[model samples]
Target: MPWSDHAIWWHVYPLGFLGAEPAALPPDSAPRHRLPVLADWLDHLVGLGCNGLALGPVFASETHGYDTVDHFRVDPRLGTEDDLVRLVEEARSRGVHVLLDGVFNHVGRSFAPFADVVRHGSASSYADWFVPEGDDFRTFEGHGHLVALDHASPAVVDHVTDVMDHWLARGVSGWRLDAAYAVPQAFWRTVSDRVRARHPEAWLCGEVIHGDYTSYVTEGGLDSVTQYELWKAIWSSLNDVNPHELAWSLTRHSALLDVFAPQTFVGNHDVTRIASRLREPRHLAHALTVLFTVGGVPSVYAGDERGRQGVKEERVGGDDAIRPAFPDSPSGLGPEGLDVQRLHQTLIGVRRRHPWLVRARPRPHTVDDTVLAYTLHDPDSGAAVAVALNYGGEAATATVPAAAWEPAAGDATPAAGDGSVSLPPYGWCVATAPTLPS
Candidate 1:
């Protein structure tokens, strides 16, 4: 089967979410067996209406689960392969798909093959597996600890293909290819084709920060790519008080739908928390309104719905703040957290009820520095939903086309005697009209 058209994703950075040590401990250190901790949150995810769990790096690694040391083994810090088996089985039982992070672009300095190259130098049989720069090997973006793999090498290709097959057999629904933009597009086509040959239902999404996303999905054989361009526009536009910026990005976002849907989100493991990034916390609802109502499969970063705050920085240990551990259950949440969680549940309900929003195109009615009004419609069914937002301190009104006007979601209500709606400061609304007969 193809991926569910209405997949609602909940992303978690496992190592950080479970509070694993920042650095890898010695081999003799007792295993933490933290994989089961996530099992405790499966119900929480289901309660939030999420159908997919997008886990960050979880394989054996030197640190942070990114510089992978072994593809076949689960990180000792997390647990044994049995733990992964149990987690996947549990998630599946709850009707949630699990997407593993595939860090194919590089390996930890300690990866056995790379270790052999380090020890034997030119005589190592694996010397050809990595990019050689004079007497040294190339690293991922200058991080000496993250050694880049040579995609040109047949051995590397086979290894990656084997890793993917191994996990898919263990019940992983798909892969979220890490740093995929850094790898050659042809390599992905080869890998994707190989994997799909055996498991045609598998879903493959890439971590593409910048570039033509259309090419990555259509030409590179990926099902989707991270929508970072739209991500940046969401927060930046709100901070700069420029709704037109969001309008332009949405226009581009609509064009991308003509090719394939991108993976959409407001906050993720790699960036600062949305609450911390926005100038005013109230604007959070407006940002989320656009995320869910716009086209694409959407993901909620772990803890974002709880109003978590963290700022990502470039210095050592900078990521620790954003990737903090979560308590094992919902009862642990504070009062404000419970409120945020309720908001997420309600908003996600709106998306789930209108799965066609996945392919709906945005039709803008108004755009200004602090106000935006648009409608998302299913062309084939004539089903439509109107969205209005006001980011300024005072309330604002937006006129909706008579045919598009309908019952609004949240606090928004119809304006008597006018085809318009009123929005409070930092407020937004989602309204749906009856489908016009085709």
Candidate 2:
């Protein structure tokens, strides 16, 4: 828990980022020792100011990582279990914490238990491990290749619990439960309670898009959940030139902060890259300004710091564009990529200085179609940072609450004697302020 408070994760989707084969390799094929390749990038990750490496599925799977086959074994495409130990050891040496993706809601058709059910029907010892429909079984979100797990089964619960404990004992810091919204809250509570009894420091974050997030954390006994509402609002509002939407989302975000620190992000592996999502390229900075300044456990999707651009569509290989492989090292990157990296470093520096922003409440001072200004204030400490964003074509200004304000980051000018902060077109700012009076 102490380590997570200072975590700024660099999330990477290993299958795509490491250029592994698109589908499962034959059982007899040679293993690929690619996990250590990620180890080589630790310097780049740490240099980027991120203290956590949040990795996508490294477990054996049928296709993409979400369709998990064997939860206990490291995918041969990623190498053996020993490869993972080395990666964890390397990360530990550099003070980087690793969080693995756990796909518990469903399993690939090839999962041993599911395969047994297919061959032996109800007579299979693993028959109760899945949800059956007549001779067939339930699929996840209509994806036939993905078989939904029967959470009600005690065997299934024990399997998931064991898998979590197995990896936690191996040195990973925590887990990110994939498709957790589809699973029952009580089921998570049962499994989490048992896991926590041993590894209380293991952070459990659910992948919840919508519904009662506060309930998911408290009732489900989870440490956190993804802030998808804010992620969508950040891009949608910027594209529509509607800061009011973002303001509303921020209000909801502050409420969640009362319960737990949601995992906040702009560009992740699932969606189009932030660089491509914004209609006006300059608004990219506006999106990130909200990500780092607002309260949450923030993450920088790999390649986003380099201004990577990729659009996700609803087709077979839509995700490929967003999850492209990286070069061997940071030195191989070009000038343009390095420029964006510098901007991220500047913003992250501001965040590192004001760590309390993880739970600071945003008090809206100005909200309009194209402009938003608010103070991220921690009432307990009387600490605050004023953030102003302008999406209009010309210059814009907004008043912030503070006795005095000095520029912290971004292109906005410093606040004046009257507490007014001004910004050029598509500009933003993060500035520190004197403690506010009660």
Candidate 3:
């Protein structure tokens, strides 16, 4: 599949974004049909310059969408399968691609096959679909209600592949394989090969938080994996007032670019909102500056562009705060959020204008405890973008290594003659070398 290097994704956790009940509704309860409401935000997302909608789990599950009860059906609380199809069509009409979260590593204890295993014991044909510990089945990350799937089972592979086929047939452009590291690499290779065979343009990214990301994209047959390391560095460095931390992480980021593009973001459904996570709120601009200028496909969590604040803790309902509901339409959003939204728009606009940045890697120009500067240059076209960040109380000065550069984005102003630039307290700037005449 050919990946859209230029894609800017807006990730939404639909279960929370739609204000759906946390627990599964009773069988007799009426369907809420909140999926259609997302259709109303298509224009808002397009206006933000996002061409991709990376939705969190939308499948039928027992509690949260991760505890899948059925891979083939859409959760009734959200809506019918038809609702998703209509939403996909609406998004496509606005020139946006839809990516679905595929949770194949685990299923709810109530999943049909697992329930059958529980009832019929070893006698059940589907018994091998799960791994048993003593008389109990293994669960995902110790969550007993979330039963882990036995990836080696042929039936399991068939069921998952068929689910992909069903959704792709309905217009899903790609799949974000959840808990991909938990499943064996061979299983992903088999499923990815089958999916690509059927839908050649299908993009597959894995939810791999740790381990050699290059191996998963190469041997494991994934196009990309989540860049959690850089995400942590972005917030942590700002909170600690340590730009060297970000510099070290960017060096590692540059190494990974040699392998494949990663799925990058500052906030997501599982983590604390970046606005609250940063010790200094004003650093939000610097954090987003890194997100947009870096070499990867970036995703904006639903409320992040609006500077929403929520802290994700380890207790029950920890994620609820981070994944709050949005109003039905943009008009309902408050006026106070417009500033943050405009910041996101400006940064994303810079990325759209310089699409080559998707492949461009950073070369460090300067690195210090409170200041970091680097240039994202394309060796092929000689195109370069210089980024400078200052996290100090006093204004800092940085010199661009390039012979000459012009301000492309940010609040810092460049000195007229020299390659020097002056950054105000907690300021940043993005500059690009002039292109030669074609």
Candidate 4:
């Protein structure tokens, strides 16, 4: 399985696309006010080799799309449903999939359906749509004015299923379930089976973070979960060049043991900016290299490709500054900009061309505090790729095993073998080794 064989999901957020707003917005307000200038912008993503764009409930007539006011219709403010339809069509034509954020976990307080239910005070037929916890299903402590919906209700179940199925029929590739863990695993299992039944080849990833990914994956509720902590660990190690710490941190992802695939990223709406965390361009490059060439799908956040470093978090004074408009090629620079333009383009090709990257395992021989070496082998296909990372502040060395570098006569790869690999300070190597199954 090449990387394309597995889904390397990416994202295009509405809040980030359009600048963040004040604390709130009216139901009739316009969000993502920048969609009109987004064609060439979006086209650039595909051009840079992103396979998909995880767009939102652009139905968010508000700041961030997470506060979805309407699930059935696209936000007229973002663009018309026809605009979205065209986006899907255009992206598909370029081999890009469009996955919308399904936010059934919650709805905006302004949502008409839920509002009527509140207004009618139980007399409304749609009252069962939300979690009936006294009079305040949409608010608590007077913050995050979101109406948590009831997934257990038949009406809600049917409604969500219908919504996903509708998009599937309209050629949407899949969905990114929001705050998936907050919803019961049983509900996800039900929705998963239903959606896959409708589109057997469809992809579904949960927003479950690293803390509970092992449990999440074991339950068979999501094909993959966001690798939040994993990305963070990798980011910290690469920036600091702490191979020992990186290796130690990666140990938490039990997915590394069993056959598992999850999404990896350095930053998103809720996390620290990757550039801010790891300032070295090469360090970031090294982390991203593992992200792509390692097992599982590698997700590139909007501004990650460019080295979007600025103030730290809001405390560090960099809350909303990183989410700037997609910068154009500088003079002769490529569309994704200079910082990571070539690296991303090149790695995307490498991932697309290699099977070991998609289906192989990250078989690290060891990470002895300074040197990190690993081999990826497609046990089923016998293809392999070896990786060596030097996390020491100074240079280090390693050697590849002969058995891992040559394929057996009748197999696609060679049998297991070992050798010491070499490396330089904070440097890494990505190369396919020949190998056989036996």
- The candidate scoring highest on TM-score is 2
> Residue 127 error for model 2, in Å?
1.2
Q: Report lDDT per candidate.
A: 0.87, 0.90, 0.88, 0.66
* Candidate 2 lDDT over residue span 1-438, tens digit each: 367878999999999999999998998899999998998889989998999999999999988889999999899998989999889989999999999999999999999998898899889999899987776788899898889999999999999999999999999999999999999999999999999999989989999999999998899999999999999999999999999999999999999999899999998889999999999988888888899999899999999999999999999998899988887777767676787888899888988988888887799999977789998876666778888999778888877874567788888754566677778888888888667645
TM per model?
0.96, 0.98, 0.97, 0.85
* Model 1 TM-score, all chains together: 0.96
Q: Report model 2's TM-score to 2 decimal places.
A: 0.98
Q: How do the residues 1-438 of candidate 3 rate in per-residue lDDT, one tens digit apiece? A: 145687889999999999998888899777779999999898889999999999999988888899999888888889989899999999998889999999999999899999999899999999889999986988899898889999999999998899999999999999999999899999999999988899988889999999888889888888899999999999999989998899899989988888888999999998999999998888999999999999998999999999999999999888889988888887889796899999999899888878888867887777876888887776677777788899887889886663467777788755556657788999899887754122
Q: What is the descending lDDT order?
A: 2, 3, 1, 4
Model 1 segments more than 4 A misplaced: 404-408, 414-418, 436-438
Off by over 4 Å in 2: none
lDDT of 1 by residue, 1-438 (tens): 146567889999999988888778797877789999888898989999999999998898988888999999888888889999999999999999999999999999999999999899879999889988876789899898899999998888889899999999999999999999999998999899999998788889999999889888777899999999999999999888789999999999999988888899999998999999999888888888888899898999999989899999999888989999877776676676777788888888888878888877798887876788888777766777888888788888886666645554666854535548788877787888765323
Better of 1 and 2 by lDDT: 2
Number of clashing pairs per prediction, in order: 0, 0, 0, 11
Q: What is the lDDT of residue 391 in candidate 2?
A: 78
Name the lDDT of candidate 2: 0.90
Top of the candidates by lDDT: 2
| Candidate 4 lDDT by residue in tens digits, 120-185 | 967999888886665467442244577788878878778778888888888888888888877777
Q: Native-vs-model 3 lDDT? A: 0.88
